[model samples]
Target: MKSGWMRGIIILLVFVLGLSIGYFLPDRKEKMDVPVASVGDEIITELMWLNQLKEDYGEQVLQDMIDRKVVFSEANRLGITVSDKEIEQEIQKMRKAYENDEQFLNSLKEQSGTTLEQLKEDMRYYLTWEKLATKDVVVSDPEIEEYYNNNLYLFQEPEKVHAWQIVVSTEEEAKQVIRELEEGTDFSTLAKERSMDLLTANQGGDLGFISLNDSYFDPSFLEVAFSLKEGEISSPIPVEKGFVILKVTEKVKERIIPLDEVKDTIRKEIALSQVPSLPQVLDQLRKQAKAQILINDNGK
Candidate 1:
């Protein structure tokens, strides 16, 4: 009986798979029809929308489609029309972000299955909706001041130590180096001659000003480094691979940066923090305008 039930479940699973396969299979005989949303005459097709979503955010493609539909509906109601110049600027920004890599450009083209022109058009629409949603938000001077006061620690620099390091692969070699250093041999010269970390060895193992918040070095080494004063050298600290000797070149005091220097940055951050409320504002604007979505094809 159990074997029979398992066979029945297997048959049902296969039938579902067959239906899914049939649904997705393209028809060569018929011309692909454009999907129309209920609100507008704009023709959005399944392939076109899916390709765009997959190109930009593969993980949240479905959520993106839903959000795009909502944005489009809201945009129409709000009379949020994006200008050609605005679209061009957005495309320019995106191009700059990916300019260093040819592979990224090629991958975008391949994933979208569209020309660069189409991609720019989509970005224009996206940015247009975004602009409409953000149109009414105003950050007052008081709000900025309050935010700065509340988060003063965020703008304050932490105490930091400027240090030089020497790493070697063996304890005996490290002891020998430490003996030479204690006898007044130059740390930088010894680092250049013996340190194993190639990236820093060339710079005489100078790690530069290491903030207390820096987690790259071993905690044991950091504890010792922070306790030392400027121009002081630490005893050889043992690690998994070998021993490390650190010299404190300088120390920096912690202090808050002035608000004038970071005013614009703080304002922008405050604006971005309020981004979640944009769609709500857009919805309010949408109630005053007219829009529609015609097709409801759930393309997987």
Candidate 2:
């Protein structure tokens, strides 16, 4: 019965292996005789291009394909699965490191050469492997509490303000804007119409949430911004280009995030620390599965 079960698994693995190879294989619609590129009438045929790729990258590419298959098989054996929602949550976690979603997507494409859909699939595979690797690892509540206590600095939020601005070329123009604002002319409307800072003007001079440590805003500008209470507007302040009016929309005081807020994150970190290195886990899984390499660079 065990031998029969092994045979079934091997068959499934072979099918998956073929699919992996097909992903890297050249398109069937393009004939091997077709020219892939030309340098002054010296044509590089599709067949030649494929042959070169096979010789140069075949071994490593094949190894990677096998590794992916092994990870999938092991994950299946262990009944571990990565849900789409989990993948999305992981992506959201990564996105926090970037300025915005578009910026994150652009960076991902430039740095990893992958689309969002491709990244989702990659995340699925990765999350699956991570689960398999850390299945037995556990983080106690005390460990989480200790980690939180030791890493208090990591959880602190600096004082920040959500602010807007209306920049003008001269102090007189800035003062005029302040007068209009005082008379109940909407600040955002004035910003859109009169602000000289073209970048934020259309968006009603929104600077978003900013901290003193941001370094993007001038020290003078930051000082004026931080001095204002929420809903208070600053008088004309001199900056590099011209005079500017500032409004503080919201203020967040510096505070350490509570242990309850970061406990799940700390738990994951502690559990991850207990898992073996990824390569070590993969090697052990491969050995247990009795994986073999049937082809080399020579394709024999």
What's the residue-level lDDT of 18 in candidate 2? 46
TM-score, per-candidate, Cα-based: 0.46, 0.67
**lDDT by residue for model 1 over 1-300, one digit each (tens)?**
112222323333333344334446666112324463434756776445434443444434333344556667667777877777767655554553331234335645555444455565566555656666565678888999999999998898888888888999988888899899989999999999999976567778887777776777778888999999898888878987688888998898988988996786677678767776655755654455443334344433
lDDT of 2 by residue, 1-300 (tens): 112222333333444454335546676424555787999969997666666666665665566667779999888887898888888887887775553456667776666556677677667777777778888988889889989888899998899888889999999888888999999999899999999987678778887777877777788788889999999999999988899999999999988999987887787777778888877988998898888789754688
Output the lDDT of residue 290, model 2.
84
> lDDT at 270 for candidate 2?
78
Off by over 4 Å in 1: 1-138, 179-186, 275-300
Per-residue error (Å), model 2, residue 23:
12
RMSD to the true structure for each prediction, in A, is 14.9, 8.3
Model 2 poorest 10 in a row by lDDT: 1-10
TM-score of decoy 1: 0.46
Clashes of 1: 8
